[model samples]
Target: MKKTLTGIFSGLAILIFILSIGLMISGTIALRRNEPVFVFGRAVAVVPTDSMVGNEPDSLDVNDMVIIRKATIDEVEIGDVIVFQGVNGSGNPILVIHRVVDIQDEGIITKGDNNSSIDQPSYQDYVSNDNFQGIFQTKITFLKPLSQMMSSSKSLIFGGLAIVLTIMLISEVIHLVRTYQDEKNEAIKKKHEEEIEALKEKQKQEIIEEILRDNQK
Candidate 1:
């Protein structure tokens, strides 16, 4: 039972670790390609700028990780922070996250909580539901730094994971060998005891036969 539970937990840990690595790889690809990294219904992004930071409630800081979920036009109410694909000043597409301060006839107007003015009057100023990736669901304040470190030292992380898995595999093999040997030894002992009991029974029958022959003589 203990071994069974150990196997279960080990399997779960390995599965979780594999999933984390996959996410890291996918996130790296998405960031480089300027695409949204989606897991289930949510998108994950690492904050590269401090535009969202300031004296406001739930402000996001640089290097923070955020989870975003799909939002409908109706669901995008005032005060809701939204993520969208937009062109930056250099005319390159980028992901932007900001709060909705006003709903307009054409679309919604957004501004960074820390910025003094609304978004520059470009294609990015007015956002529609079609441009939306999602609304901010939650944030992981400390994960971005760790993720950056892991991404920078991928070789070291891979080596560590390999070593740990090798050790676990070796331990499992040793346990299996010891269990097999113990069972074999127990079987041999049982057989030896059975043989000795049979010998004693044969000797008792022989002695009784000898006593009967002497009485007849």
Candidate 2:
């Protein structure tokens, strides 16, 4: 039972390590290209603003980590929260997360929950299928704290990866040593048993010889 539990935990650790590496690589690429990185049709984002904050349960807060799934324009409906690429006041491209208020023949109109009015058409324009990123699925409640920590200390992530690798290395070394010790002990036991068997055979032969001598006399 202990070994089984160890195996399960080790498997989880390895899986987490692999996921971390993939995220690191993908994040680096996204940074270079200035775009969100999606893995397996899903993307994670840390909320930068409280525009979606409200009294509702689904309202988003700053620093919250959310999971978004790739979706088409047809897959979204009114009131569905979505992430899309838009331009800021300075014409610089930015990502916006808002709830769809209305769907028009031309494009989709979105408004933030805390905002008084919909996004300005001149600034953001109507969201079309071309700039649609994904639909918000849910907030990552468990990893929200971790996300904040990582954002504050970028080195923490690499430090965690290092620790995981060290642990795995130590586990492998210990396993090898134990395996070698077990094999060595088994070999010693086999040799000792063979020696005892040989000694018993010699004594039996001597007894037989003694019996033969007595019979001859």
Candidate 3:
């Protein structure tokens, strides 16, 4: 029984370690990419005060985990769900996730298929063809709980993150220590040069002192 318990615990620990490493690698890659740094780089922006709620055409719950991405028209096709900065009553600098009603060179126009009137503005001037977050991939409420894993937890979340970071930091410190030892070894070779310079300076001072003494004599 003791051995069995030990095996189960060991397995759990191994899984946890793998998960820890996975999170670290993900963070490093996303930091390089310059996209938002999320646990999975995914978000659950609550439908705050109903501003964007019911604005999405396909449908989204009051609090939904929107899977937003970065992309352009080539990536986005007709009928794909997307989120963009819309100048609607969506509460200033609004992020609206609606269907692509039409696409234009200047910008793209979208509307909540559920809403009676189309949004008030166009993204032509605002959205550069150069850069765009692709669009919302899907609307599923099931993954909502997973988003909570992206947040504060004393034991599970923060502790796991801390353990992973500590490993990286320790590796860096070991590298620096090794480098310092190498530099120290090189300095040992310079000891003879330092001694030689000191001796030369001493001889010059002695010669000057001797000349002064001879003149006095």
Candidate 4:
């Protein structure tokens, strides 16, 4: 029973490790492409700015991980926080997360919770099905901080992951070696017991022959 449970747990751990690696690889690729990572149509994003942060403790802050899902333009309403791609000062695509304050035929107006004024009208001034990714559904805190650290030093993170996988592999190898040794020991013990039993039977026969010879005399 103990061995069975151990095997079950080990299998589960390996499965989890594989899944984690897959997620990390996919997430890295998506980030490099500046795209949202969708798992079953739900997108995951790390909050890069504190624009949505407020004085409340429950408010979304920098490094908070947000899960986004696709929504139509007609489904969007005022006061809903949305993530969209916007051009930065350098004309590069950047993700912006803010709440919609007003809805217009052209586009939606957005502002940060902590900001003083609304964002200026520009190419990103309106929300459309093409540029709009989705609305934020959940906020996971503290993971963003860890993600930032990992992003800053990718080599270290990758090295650590490599080390962990190596350790797991080594552990499995050790378990196999130990199991083989145990089986080998059991076989040796069983052979020794058989030889001892054979010796005892031969002695019993010799005693019976000696008694028969005395009776014949």
Candidate 5:
């Protein structure tokens, strides 16, 4: 029982740590990138492709963590990974993570690392700095496993963990309640026993007093 309780609490603590680190990473990036979607603009973006792998570009990996940095259109230089909003009809505000292949006076041209060629030929015209979210600067490790988890059967992963945690928490509560009730019942029983002993002592003293009165008579 002790071990189970300890394990449950320990798991919960670790999970909380994972969550806090993720939040801090994301929040810090969102703050630096000026993203209203996250508090403090410290948002993390995904490494969309492996172009940066052999390129020795920051040792980044596919699905690795990337910190977002809000910069002016002028600062969007070559080789930097930029995340931006795509055109209309895109679902859920598309976030395109691509390296800056070319920067022009009016727009930028981006390309995927693993792909055979650059993005749509119309890429240059679609580039909008006003819609830019942030540029990738650093890596965030805590989000990698979380990213994998969410990618693989997100509902099942989250639901299963939630169920397990809830069960453990509920069991702990029940165990504590039982312990408290047992202590209360034991205390009441002991109090009753003490009261009985006290009554017997009183009776003995009364009998002695009655005997003394009879002798005087």
Candidate 6:
């Protein structure tokens, strides 16, 4: 039972470790391509700016990890926080997460919770149905620190590899322990068999002596 439990736990740990590495690798690739890594229609993002920080309970702070789910334009409504693709002042595309204040025939208007005014025209000019990404689901408090650590592609890769190495080391230790136990058990078994053989020989010699005495009588 103990061995079975150990095997089960080790298998689960390795499975989880592999899955974590896969996520980190895929996430790094997606970030490099300037895209979100979607998993089962959901994507996780790390907040880089404090634009959405406010007194509201749901306000997002910098380094917060959030989960977003895919949504359609028609499903969007006023006051809903959404992620969309926008452009910066230099015409470079960037992702923006803010609350939708209004929906117009052309597109939607979004504003940060803590910002003094609405987003500039340049930023939201390209915010259309095609640019819509997903709707905010909830913040993941536990992953906030990990998300912060994985801010860059290099760090993400390094952290992932480090974890993989750690898991491998643990697995090796378990394997060594099992090997030692098996060897110890085999030695004990051999010693018991040798002692039994010696006892059988002694018994046979005593029986022969008794038979010779009976024949002499």
Please, what is the TM-score per model? 0.55, 0.58, 0.41, 0.55, 0.46, 0.58
lDDT of candidate model 2 versus the reference: 0.75
What clash count goes with each model? 0, 0, 7, 1, 12, 0
Stretches of model 2 off by over 4 angstroms after superposition: 1-23, 150-217
> Lowest-lDDT window of 10 residues in candidate 4?
157-166
lDDT of 6 at 204: 94
Task: Kindly list the per-residue Cα lDDT of model 1 for residues 30-60, writing each as its tens digit.
Answer: 6667656665556655666778997766678
lDDT of the candidates, in the order given: 0.72, 0.75, 0.54, 0.70, 0.61, 0.76
Tens digit of per-residue lDDT, candidate 4, span 31-100? 5666665554566656667778986443578767666876777788887888887776688887788888
1 against 6, candidate with superior lDDT: 6
Q: Judged by lDDT against the true structure, how good is candidate 6?
A: 0.76
Give the residue spans of candidate 4 off by over 4 A. Answer: 1-29, 55-58, 120-123, 142-145, 151-217
Q: Per-residue CA lDDT of candidate 2, range 1-217, in tens?
A: 9998799669867866776676678667664554566655666677767789987666798877777888888899998999988876688777899999998877999988998889847558788878888999888667667666655664764343334334444456567668987999999999999999999999999999999999999
What's the CA error at residue 138 for candidate 4, in Å?
1.4
Model 2 Cα shift for residue 35 (angstroms): 3.1
In candidate 2 the C-alpha lDDT for residue 3 amounts to 100
List, residue by residue over 1-217, the lDDT tens digit for candidate 5.
9998899778767765665556546544543553423323344445544655645455567767566666666777888777776532333444677777877665777776665566545542346667666777677666677555544673543343343334434455557768987999999999999999999999999999999999999
Worst 10 residues of 1 by lDDT: 157-166
